[model samples]
Target: MKKKHHRVALFAATGVAALLAPAALRAQESGAIQLEQIDVSGGPAQARTAGATAEKGAVGPIDARQLLPADLQTFAGSASRVSSQDLANQRPLTTHDALRNVPGAATVSDDGYGRHSGISLRGSPFRRSRKVLVMEDGVPINFSTYLDAGTHYTPPMDRLESIDVLKGPLVNYGPLNNHGVVNFRNLSPFGPKETVFSAGVGSTEGADQRVNNTRHAHTRQTFDNVGVVLSYSGLNAGGSWDAERLGYDDFYGALGIRGDNQDLTVSGGYFRQRDRYDEDNFSGTLADFKKYRHDKKRAAEAGHFPVSCGRCYEWNTYNADYFRAQVAHNLHIDSKTTLSTRIYGNHHDRARFYVSDDSDNPPSDFVMEGRDRLYRNYGADSRIEFADLPLFGGVTHTVQAGLRYEEHFFDNKNRLGSTNERLDFGNRGSLDGKQKLTAQSFAGFAQTAIQITPTFSVVPGVRLERYKISFRDFDEPGNDGHSTYVQALPMLSFAWEVAPTTTLYGGYHRGLSPHIVRDVLDTDTGYIAPKKEIGDNLQIGVRTKAVRGLTFDGAYFHSDIRNYQFGEAFQSNLGDRVFSSLDKARFDGVELSARLDSRAFTNSPWNVYGEGVYTFVNSKIVRGTADGGVNVAGNEVPESMKHTANLTLGVEHDSGLDASLSWTYRGSFYTDALNLPMNPLDVEEGKVKGVWLLSARASYKVTKELTAWVSGQNLTNEFYVSDRSDGAKPGVGRTVMGGLTLKFH
Candidate 1:
């Protein structure tokens, strides 16, 4: 490892030297070239042509281009904005933690570290994740089975460069855009002149220790026109709660080749996590305890009775590997047309382990415990575009179309242990089981934006999708079902420059999401069915540089979900079985944001920027059934917070130093779906309350070759629970981390 590190360092230094030598010679000949003059709020060309507008608008109004990563967007569009900086400010370790500030969004967790976090969008709960498409660089990451479970096991946060979240049915991108879409773009190859390395360690609850290390290097001359980036991270921590301990490791790398007018990029990565934790039983109610106090005491003394010995421990593990490759060709089909095409493929594998045990001792008799599962996916995608259409009003239009194909496989196994002499029971036969699932889907979509006027435009688009599924099991007779679904998702949006510094926009769209095998499969009865989801979304917003050194954007949105999916507990002689069904829901919300950027803050060392956001949401289950009974007509949805807010202030200096402070708040919420009184014995209900968190970070450059930074999260040491299924367990506490970076160039 030491030798490899040394070689990488040497190669980085050599590449940097090669780039600087030529630039230094050119600088000596030029002698102090002048700097370009332009407005900071808008691009150079726009600033030069719209000087009046620039003066009217804020000094540095939020730029849409800045909201997205440098290489991701094709053109500056609407002001709906969120950025990587915002995510970093939140210090999110899971996707649920990251979406806390977004409107109409909430998260539920069955385990920490994203092991089983479920995302609810626009009031839809427990629906097949296929309803919400997840993509990496325009390629679908959800397997052919159309489920988001992969995220719980193989979260891509460690390798993400940025995340772009689009709310509502966004058909323009492709099929499977029903509830919404989250697009994750990976970090690109760095320049030859840069190298970065960092390491940090911290402690959590229950004597848990967390440590991580990362390295990034950009080489410009490794293969004439090639550049590469490699990164690796490992995390291990003991549980803050009894019997909770977990560890994970991840690796990622990318290589790219740049030609005079074209680019090719290839990347691959892997992640693994192992966890062990105790499970708590929810049936130990206070009434039962009061009634059985005497019996419980006697049982405890004898050590033979189960005093709610809800003390079962569990072990879980997950592993995943993925590979992707993309190529882009820039060409001029003719003097009037320019075209670009991107083609890519992805492959992923996953495995999981689960174990449960009761009391301090293994069962004296035959014990039932352990489960194992495996999954794999493969897919390919392509996109092509034609620009500069010669037609009505000298308009320019872009048409995009693509196709995707995927396959999935799954396997499951169960284990039972032999009985002990004390139980006088014989060993039970072990059960080996396996199941396979396969699915195929195809979609084609197109959109056109016509320049109706110099300052106005209209975009109209539609998409068509067809899908099928098949299943087989080796252990028992497997069931298979096939259904064809077609949806015409239509969208129309308009943008008008009301004034040089202001813009107004509004649009309505139709969206669809397909159900997953889990949603349709009956684990207890071996029954299968197909489910579909649809919704209508409407939004209106205005953005403007209302004053000097300030920019403001706000919007109001309403989404009505039809045939939404929710869980129903079925009572049987054996036990209770949970199943998925269609339910109606409505989600309405308002979002507002403001940003200030100025160099006028008391002669600060660097530019100063401040931002704030507030969101109000109302979510409810309009119609549904639970446990074979009608649901209340006006019940609020579980895990939906009424209000959320965020604020941040920061400064970045030219001297390679930066600092910032951020605060976040979430309103109180009810944990149960029925909204009934929580069991008195359940500590989780009693612990519910609103929460506030504060964090601060700063970094300083020691020299051109070295840098160091420190961050203090949850500075106030606030104790709060992010979620509680039955009883309350506090979320993470105050954490502090410090790290140093070394640059080879």
Candidate 2:
């Protein structure tokens, strides 16, 4: 009966897609827009095609209004983009949801709102708090201290104004540049300065409510600029799964201030988030005697055993606080010299807790665990440009240099005890541990662009980096260690303006991601060893705006990775121990995207727009010590979908009414290292079929200051598996949400 219900729901969603296909095709035809000319800055016009400097007319210092109507920066490269308009339109409750449209991205959820969420990019081997880099307003958030248990926390999405994502290890001006980079650009203090407030309520597992208020004020008479934003949310409800467990609640807030002068700008902010959740354990197969009988018929036949039928409750909590400040200054030393310097500092404190079997049914055992981690980071970066140099045909050149330093401290403690003291079986004890780690690095790069002709240009560049890591454990001696590594990255590229509407470009570069505290820490000995990863990537693409209202961009890329980090499981008489290992991997893929903006009727009130993206990836493990040297060379990388696509269609009018409908689909994927067969929980074996998601939203203006909107997501009530692992169940079923917005200036 359960299988039949699942089939019925799948068929219904397919029917809806067939019904909406024609309308989507028509919308695509009416809303297409031609691509615009790209602006190149800093380096010679020819060098813009290379990685030398940003394009001149490119949208620097993003603005809110420009985010609408599709901008070139979003499509400049195969990677890197953040659409403020999309964020406003989607109003995602979590950061993971906001990144659903990015290329080569996937997310897994441990719970609602504030549970564990993990992301995989371009088939990187990192998982469960490893390898990835996250930053808040240019400040590194990862601790440099020794191996820590809890390093995977992000600020609430509501406090962020934009998110910038870079898919592979790329050299950026900051610490913690590992597998990928995600920069959370918080709301800045600028503009006319206004006060805005909003409140909302929704239904999911239960009831939810949120309120947000912000004040932006500035005084020209004073040399100081200040801004503050505060928000609060509450959730009290039942969950969709099991129907017996309750949901969780989360609260977060942020405050920011800034000051600016003719050649300098300084800003700082503070943020905090608190979360609580009820944990749910995974149920094994029915054959296992310890498994709880969720089936009603089985319970009845067994005479309703209370211990095996009752629900269990677990409690978990997380609290985090972060503060950051940065300064940027422009320097003028010579007629042809332009330079800029930036420096920043960041500090964070985090605490987490977990409690199992809170009710202690059947006098079962209960356990509690907690951890605290603190981190501090500092960095300084500068870029200089020298134009019309006589060294090479009077070509232009740019030099970039930077230095970064970080300090981290991790203190972990765990205690276990039974619900009843009489049942204490020698398992009740406490363990305390502490570790410290530090990282320091310096980098220098130089690139020059040569203009050979009016229509063609070439640029070449190279960068050198030196990194050092040191670790020490206060609780254990003989665990102190230090390691250092140096690397050089070179890049070259060329661009040709073949026609007024066509541009052809290509480039090749080297990248690296260094191992940190987590890579070296031995769970038993509390000792760690440093590891490093290096890779090279090649890319070629063509961008065109041939038609009057249609623009397209496509790219092909291949990356070779050496010394990749992986986890290995070992069994001992004491227990099972998992340690980090080194392996080699490779990733290759293609991506294509297009946007169309058009007006069907010159005088009509209806205007249509459409945007779409398609990605194809093939990632594999080339060499590894396990598997008897049998290469799993052709298998698709774990968690990376073979193909993914999204399409959006909308209509707008001059009268302040806008409506849009969107569809997204993700291909089947694997979830484990071995890609084993015959396992129901194996993502690669069960093969979660592709799903079509449909959402529609519309807005109506009540007055100049207020506007109300009604939106529905997953209207077809599609039951799809967003993520799955060895023993974890997929995400919840269909969800529906609505909201309203107001402006006061």
Candidate 3:
């Protein structure tokens, strides 16, 4: 039944695209629309070309209005961008690797492929990146941003054109924007004809002798007014421990049509993964980490490396299937007015098979338990931009307004089975629990940039959001519950051009985050619907390029968070997670990013460059209650690292040879609100020690069509623990990968 429903939604999205193409073709007969001119700061000139028409006299075309500005320097917010060149130089193995350069982002890897990882920003706790808003080409990607905003899937780095991180006053984004927003810009379908293929393989240092392979193929072509793009990325890898493996496949395609005054783009993708890498089975205690930190062979022999039990690895598994489709259209009403609209839908299915491991049960005991979860959503967003408006004397205003509608559906079921049975609905044992949840939202926002003076601007925006959430428990009819929420979020910002090459910016915004469905409405004793999370955020930043060969950016920010949420692990059964609401917290931080190239000062063939990102934050609970009814008002928030930094140095020659090295550091942080020094029994309450990793990459262009590269991560072979949410999860050891790419027209 679920598969049938998925096909219907997929077909419906495709049908919408099919209908829009004919209308776009008919618009070709209309008169040409006057083009508007705007200057873009950096990156490729035709970065976002699918739904955009080239301006008459602009440096580059405008973005699709995906919340952030095309010119990052003029925006009155703190923003960080990673370009295609950076990706090429780094040769990252996962999405987290590509995001290492972004300041204020704390990335934790629980799986070798980054399929299950954590990304925390500001003072947000790192748990599958629930606090951050993640998007792909301006569309929200989380299964349910309001009900359950957890990261289950992230687009492979192979298909990304660029990455943008935005902070401060994001009125155009959503309820999960309390920390910030991360956007992955996809490659444009309307590009020059070309085909590219790459393949790579690597091995990590361990007694298990695990190896991993990666492959990617991308091709695109333009035929007059029509263009099409197709791409695929695949990965097969070994996990961090013995008897575990991971594999995934991703497929994507796009069709674009261009008219005289309008453009339309339709894109779709399917991703699937099956793995035996369960965090519960992969994690161990602190004593186990210390014993096996350096020697995998001895630890394996001791039967305590992963766990004392021997049969845990064979029975744990995870699987996921995700599908998404989107249609985007842009209309040039006039030279100074335009409209952009996007309709998108996605379906995701996930299953995890796990079992109990205790002292009473034997290692070979077959009592299997699992959870099957399904999430689907459909949304439509439309916005209009009015540029170069003469609103008042000596003042020009650029106004933007938009409306959005979204509906989400989530279904979860718990089952128990024998060891011989698979995770099939009929084959799996009896159903222990069943739930169906839904969320519907209606939102509208408007923002205006008032250029009162040639070198100064002020932007004010507000968003009104209305949402309804429903929960139903099939097992227990009395547990059914529903709630409705209405919120008004406001934002104000200003940018002043202190110098021709420098800009000073500041912003203030009110943020909101709704409660997750399970925490608010569940079959638990003494259940109380917790208040929604709210925050008041303020930030001041500066961007400067006054130095001939350097660019610098710095920002200071503060956030007063109310009703902060924390996830407590191992509170009941082993590896189980429970969410609790704390009273209030405060976060203060400073972010810095800078880059310099020696070639800018010296006209030489070799360009020596350096880039760095550093962040310092202090997160403390001003008023809160910890577990056991303890008053922990002055404790530090869990997983709030005080300092994080990444630095890179590289040299590039005109002959297409480049080499770079990067060093990343993460500061120590507490694991619970009680601020315990250590707890050997639970192993989830303690201060996690800090660690540093070093990576290096070198590439050479052997010919016009062939390029080769090699990279190494964790060159020092550090023995460190990356996370302790469930238990002590060790970080990846030293790894070396090499690949070759062939490109041709």
Candidate 4:
């Protein structure tokens, strides 16, 4: 380990020792207490689940067929959880690998570092992860949901307690509820007061033996009433085939406290990372990709590390600061009714400096671009849940209603090089233009769970939202616009207990995705602004634990998309052109997942799990354009994948040794609405080929406080392509990493 990392680790470890000593001494004085242990082999089949870590509920852990309030569990929809222990074991270097198990999710990275990773859900556009609602403990992280939602800030997964994934029409949640929700919940301060720490060092190697090293350290402490968690992670890495040198330094710190009836938490993060845009596809003709298949290092290697190498400097730097404060209070108001109120404020500042990619005129004087942006969002939310409400027609009802007021402001400044060409970016560029947006939103929602019988329940929900936006263009005052949209979203769902261990659920809801300032404002050409995206979502699924030791959740989903538009490259038998936006698409998909614990079934310490998602997009262009492009009806949807799946099988011993093998498949996706190459000058395949990879991990617990683990990624070293939009960026190559974990409780 480098001295830099050692200093970081030592600093955190010293704090841990200082805190734990006193806590341990006091516990000993008061008589030590320990958690109960469930012996898997000696108990009945049902007892196996007592300590088993499987799916998690919104507030607590849950069993497969258990019943919970809609707010406490995912009802009439699909959801999943990944625990903190799982993240520690994998030590995933990229966000794509961290979310691989989530069905109907596809991730693309310009570089393996996940600096600006894009997460596409159910055929959402593969741009910045704009469509998905990203929240840390239900608080927004990006700038503005409707002004500048696209982002470059993602908290490292290592600091999370668990990740909650909900896929469906979240009619009960406001803001961007159309696509889906992926909430990364941070660890809270509760239970025993102690400290936990994890540190690791590893490396990844490509087919030609090129390697990139990685190092990370995490520490968390829980005092009696106050808790603190600090994390510092750094990565010095390079790409497999692209050879893009990258460096990253991220710091996160949060202070939280819990009381009997009130809890307050505050957290903030800062990071600076060098981005390596591997635009190798723009290097040469199609034959170049095939000729240098094994050894292909392109323009990305020019300016990342510098070292006096005056190759057209393309170094891109991104910096961001994130801070959020949340306060919550619970009032009993009686034994059967409770009122919970939460208020939070979030502030973000981000900037990106880089050379814009010009595929048509590469190797010439490139355009230097600077993107500076600001985002501020604050909101207050209050909800009251009645455990027992008035009954109607001999049915029981548990109702909850909430009101929220949210406000946000955003600013974007773009600067371009003076001559459309620049060698050194030290010279300030010309201000191309600036855009500003102000938004205010008020929302209220009510939902009720009516238990018709002991075995069946029905839920109905409704939400009213009033949103207004003001957009101003600095250069063109005439292009300024003010838009206000008021609408009501509704949902109806049902759950039936078909058997003791099987529950069937289905729901239908109207999902809405709000439009941002860029998508809502008119251009200088008098172009009509695109409307917000809407989807009528329907889903049906069954969660079963009928078979002892086996848990399965299978579902079928369909989304009717309307008025959703995005930039797309289109090419048919006719000439090729890139449209500003494409519209009117539909997506249909199905997912199946299962998990098994062998100990419950055969008295053996083994487990197996797998999940698969297949989405079919019947996308078409309902509107036409005067531009000579393929926006005609019946055209294929751009950047939509037909199939994607993941499977895993693993085994764990009672003595704490475990091993797992996983495989992921990404199907070929079209790059244009016409489903053909967009390069009319040289017609080629427009689809980025599918990629298949195998990953394996093995870990052994040598003692109560020490564990060793090793991870293998892309073991087969498969030569595959990931994205073909601007250029072909290849998939991650083969790599191996190992590390140790230390814990004291």
Name the best candidate (by lDDT). Answer: 3
The digit string of per-residue lDDT tens for model 3 on 650-702 reads: 99999899999999997788877878775554444577778889999999989
Candidate 4 residue lDDT tens string, 359-458:
2243454566776677877776666555435588756566667776777878777867744554222443677789888877878888776767766777
- Relative to the true structure, candidate 3 has a C-alpha RMSD (angstroms) of 5.4
Quote model 2's TM-score: 0.74
For model 3, state the Cα shift of residue 187 in Å.
Answer: 1.4
Worst 10 residues of 2 by lDDT: 21-30
Candidate 2, 1-745: lDDT as tens digits: 3453344334333432332211000011111111122234565554322111322311111111111123332222335456556666555655666766665554444444423445555545323434455566555555542233224455555445667665422343322333356666654433333344444444442212222122222221112343333333333322223322322233333333332211344656555544543222232332431232222223322422212322222234455566766664443344334444556566666555444333344335545545555676555555554444444555443333333333333433334434533211123234446666666566666655445454455556666777676777676657777777788877665556577666676666676666545446665765656666777767777777876667777777777777665443221111222333337677787777777867732557767888776777687767654334445555545555666677778777777777877786666665434554424432213334457777677776677766666655556755444444323233443445455566566
Rank list by lDDT: 3, 4, 1, 2
Candidates 2 and 3 compared: the better one by TM-score is 3
Model 1 per-residue lDDT tens digits across residues 1-745: 3453344334333432332211000011111111122233542233221111111211111111012223211122322323455544444555555664554454544444444435654444422243456566555666543432334443435445556556632454544454456665555553343345555555443323344222233222235556666767665554434345566666667776654333345666665555553223223444543333213223223332222222223223333444544443222222222233344444554444322334234332223434444555544433333333435665544444444444444444444434321110122225446556555566666655455665665667676666665665555564444556667778776656677656676576777666555446655666465666666777777667746777776667777767655433221221322444437667787777777887653566668888776767687777766444757557765555667677878887879777878787755565545655444664334224567778677777789877677766567866555555423444555656666666575
The C-alpha lDDT values of all candidates are 0.49, 0.48, 0.74, 0.59
Q: Which stretches of candidate 3 lie over 4 Å from their true place?
A: 1-66, 207-209, 281-287, 294-308, 358-364, 419-429, 522-527, 571-575, 679-683
RMSD of each: 9.8, 13.0, 5.4, 9.3
Error of 1 at 721 (Å): 3.3
Candidate 3 residue pairs that clash:
none
Higher-scoring candidate on TM-score, 1 or 2 = 1
What C-alpha lDDT does candidate 1 achieve relative to the native structure?
0.49
| Runs off by more than 4 Å, candidate 4 | 1-74, 88-91, 191-194, 206-219, 240-243, 277-284, 293-310, 356-367, 417-430, 519-529, 569-583, 606-631, 677-685
What shift in Å separates residue 719 of candidate 3 from its native position after superposition?
Answer: 1.2
Ranking by TM-score: 3, 4, 1, 2
